[model samples]
Target: MAHPLELAEPNVIDEELIRNCITTVEEISIAEDKKKEMKTETELHDIKAVSFSFQNILRIDNLNGLFSLVKLQLDNNIIEKIENIGHLVNLEWLDLSFNNIQNIQGLDTLTKLTDLSLFNNRIEELKNLKTLQNLNCLSVGNNLIRDVVHAITYLRPFRKLKMLNMAGNPCHKDPEYHMRIVAHLRDIVYVDYRLVDPEKVQQAREQYQEDLFEILEEEKKQAEDEKKAEDHQQWLDTLSEANLSGVDTLLKVMLDEDPEQGKLHHLSFWLEIIDEIQHEFKGMSKDFIDNTLNANKAKYAEKERFIDALRSSRQKSDGDSIALVGKFDLKKKKLMRQLEDLREDETVKKLRELQDLNTELNDDLLELGLRQMEADDQIVSDFERRYGDLVNAFVEAAQNGFFAKIRDLENAFHTRAVTMATDELEHFAAGQLEDVTDEAQIFLGDKDIVFASLNASHDAHLGIIDGLEDQIVTKERKTFNTLVAEARAESHTRDRKRITEIATVTARNNKEIVELIQSEQEGWNR
Candidate 1:
């Protein structure tokens, strides 16, 4: 008397609705079965696959009983996370493509999974997949993945991965991307839906092996650079804390005495102090320049090594074709066919175009570096000119009435000091002199240490300014590197696209050639 069960309508999926749909299917199966044993509720529990794609399902819940599930299709849905799928221990195929998922998770129990399609998702990394040892085919194309090398490293544990589709990801556009992936994932038979050419794989492995040492060296240099930066920062902090301690003691000794008595000190005594401070500052400037030049030299040497490695790799690829053929034991017929194809193909043409573009980009990058250097030089020149003007102004002002104004100011303070105790008067005079020394340090610090404590303070301020300028340069360099990376990625992407197009056209041409060869053989047989 009950109404016959039917498939659920395209509505929000819930636990009760899913159960009802399962029960309905079971009832239908029972009605269709002729044998009594086959018409039991046990057949309902054996359901292995479920398709809820485009079913307006907002959440994946209440499927605790479907333990026998092997396949689940939730593609083109509004699902945002991979949740509640752990109960499907036998799951083999999962299609969550065209969803909103960001992270790959909740599949630790599904060790039997072999095929997974997560294309067109928000996945930025390939982590949290360590337990899926049985996974073989993975499609994560059209995602936010960058740094193909790092992504490949994440996938290194999945040795069983034979087919990987990473096309349409930003990483797909990296230079030598195909070679890198093939070299890393040696067992992968298909990459981005294309058959892996064995010859290409071997070539990639050889090339990668040749450059591996250079890459490691570069990494070591980067680590060293980072450590150097940290050490420099620590040194700066210590210098700032310890700066002017000696100058402070000298100031206290000079200013705490009676003004008339302090005036009796020879000019040579102050001049000697000033000369010592100038020498110290000169030493610091020389050391700074030497360190900067050394760093630049190391950077230039690293770049030269990188360029040499690149040239060596290119030369090896170009000059050793015969040797490579012999080494790989290539068949004569296949080699001949490949040679013919290469002659007619646009791969070389595209490579030339890319090389030209790369040359132009390199020129631009060099120009940018030169411009940055020029800007830095200009800033230094401006700072020096401004500093010279400040010193000249201070000298001119001093020659006029700077000391007279200070003497008049000191006389007024002296009059007030007479009304106070001698110790209090000395303290007050010292405080007043400290203020004057601070102002004088701005310009005279370079020539003399009349305001030696103030000079240290000024140097600390300059150090902070220098640090800021360095940070600016570092930021600009990072921006330039990013721009260069993006340009190279774009060029590589274009090259790959052109190669794919040419390959498609060549396949058709090869088909025609095959048909003609077959026709000629048939005629000869006749």
Candidate 2:
């Protein structure tokens, strides 16, 4: 038999551990401000910075959920693999030094990482970190890099990189390690832990003239691309500031400008999202209608047939008209109660689903807006893509209609059924008051009429539902088109205003940049 402690999970990062860590951290923050009271980030979504550095952590697991983590410290652990940290899209600083990790593989989604330290690991090569374009400080010293020159080249794409450390590797002893690696990179301010000497940098560049020229050319291209990206981003910021970022506005602009681009790509993204919401709601609606029909149809048929048999049977009743009316009233209450359930329960459920769908639509669109820039190629790309899905999405969205109309129609059916059933009972009860006929036969006769009325109402409600599909579709299309047209008119004025504002701001910022550059150099000397 295994020991109790050994049988349990050994190196798991569980909720209890996380709660302790987060609460301790929050207490420290709370000391500064009473309102900064920490909530347990067991889900790991709210915490901005954390350290699991000295923990006896063997693996990086149980760290799922959308992490808003900005800085994480996991150094000095027995970790051998770099896994389960990709959801940290906002992660910028990470320290995994002094570990048994052999590779730098799992850091793709960390595009915003600016500072990373993976020193004193078993890392053989410095590849697969290209996604971290924003990286400026990298420390991979004491690693297993076999070729310093080849490894240095991997840092070429990261033009923003300014610090590097390969001090304790095998290639650190290479005769050309200092000169060649230094020459290959342009913007590096520090190597290992020391400031780069200007005189030594010049000598190294001269020593490796041919290689330095290629490196310099590559750096030049990188600069140009960076500038292009900057300008594009500035334009995006201006567009956002102009207050023209709603889905309706975005779709309308794409639809209008698509002809010039000769592609329908941007419009299609909008269409796909709308279509998804529409498809989901339509599916819910269909299932609800099917269940309602299947459940109530049997009830109607059975009750109608039973009442028919009861009316024709020779069962005797000596009760007078008052007793007969009482019996009819009892039947009336039961039938009304059934109708109440049908009206309230099913309709309320549908209404709740509608509310849920509205919430879902808002959340989906919000996420799409957030993730949009990653896929955006300036303006939804060239106009050569398919428009079929786009058109379908719009049609579907128009038809989905929040399910309010459907719910109303459903209530109408239940109300009508109840009204008809009760009226028939009342009419029969009145006949009893006027003439005390064979009470059993009369009551059965009235019940037979009630079931017949329900059966007819059920058929009519189904017919109304069948016709509802086209009615909502037509109404929603008209509503969507009218809104789009109004938005188009509003956009015209906003476009002219946006152009003027952008031009003014660009000119002012350019002047400011020139002044800031001179001041920056002056400030650096101080």
Candidate 3:
């Protein structure tokens, strides 16, 4: 079996395999010179994306022909250093995560890269990525990054970076790590897996602002102190030179007079000493006077400088005050003009007129509403009167018709009962006489029995018909009542709808009037 890390037949260039591995391809033609003759060479143009992730590849090589490649995924590999990828000029996305890479290098040409993933790598410092200006997303999590500030400084050139993943790195373990990173890289929207909100960024800025100001102030003070020390050293050098010359002259004069004197020389020496003392005293008095004059001159010079500074400051203040007064006068004129305009505004005058007219209009509308209500009441009363009359007439007509129908049915039933009873009695008499020896006695007894049976049957039929008529009358009365109730509900709905329409119209008119007044006021303001 072949080694798992090696590609089968590594030396062979399988065009078909390359095409299969590539996600997208384009075709193009290139000019080629063959045997001193120019020919157009057609070839598979370029691969757009290639994924060899987890392929156990040892090195990133043999990809020189993919000039237009935009994305390459080579994560989980044994590659050590980032190399051999400088030719991918159009590459925008690269994944080298989970690799043995210790340093980021050889990516100088891939300037179009917008996303780069070096997660789970041995890479330490964020370096050699300064040229990737278009980079927006970077994932270097689980790496060996230590100095957060150094990393921020290194990544500062990538101003468009919006997403950065630095989790599991040594730099991310610091206290307020997210704030530190956000404070430096304010353009980033996402750090690690956390979304950086505007409030956090603001808080970071506020938290660090005082520290930054203190640092700047300390630097300024250090510079000033250094300058003052330099000036003090120069002054000390000048004073030492003056004092050294004076001491040298006094020593020379004393040495020249000391050796020649004895006892009388001692007396002469004493007298010379007294005379020298007097001369020294006179010189001291003159030097004191000169020193006093110099001190006074220095004091006067300082006072003049102070006076000049005060005069300059006062002049500036006066100039600023004059400018402010000029501005105040201009603003006052403008305000006076605005006040005059407000006083003379035609819109305000029109508004007053409209207010007076509105009162009259409201009075007229109220009177019209009262008249409408009275008219509506009169109409309702007339409608009720008409409805009542119609109902009464319909009821009277229905009652008369129902009574006529009932009377006719009753008369018809009576006639039919009498006819049937008479026919039945005759048939019984005829049949009895045919079979009887005592015809007259038999006929009399059967006739009474037949008449009694017919009467009972007729009465039962009349009772059934009466019950059916009562049921029909009840059902008709219920149907009529239902119809009347429905009609009343419909009338009420129509009246309510009419009232709502009138109210809506009134409200709309009022809104329009208010809007007109507001528009007029706005126009005047403008």
> TM-score of each candidate?
0.36, 0.41, 0.36
Which regions of candidate 1 are displaced past 4 Å? Answer: 1-11, 15-44, 210-526
Report the C-alpha lDDT of model 2 over 116-215, residue by residue, as the tens digit. 9999888988888988999999999999988987887888667899999999999999989988777878788899989999999999989999987877
Ranking by lDDT: 3, 2, 1
Quantify all predictions' global Cα lDDT against the true fold.
Answer: 0.57, 0.59, 0.59
Residue 45, candidate 3: how far off, in angstroms? 3.3
lDDT of 3 by residue, 403-456 (tens): 344345445544654565466456555753343234433433465544454455
Model 2: ten consecutive residues of lowest lDDT: 378-387
Question: Which runs in model 3 stand beyond 4 Å of their true positions?
Answer: 1-17, 24-44, 210-526
Query: RMSD (Cα, Å) of candidate 1?
Result: 28.4
- For model 2, the stretches where C-alpha displacement exceeds 4 angstroms are 1-10, 23-43, 217-526
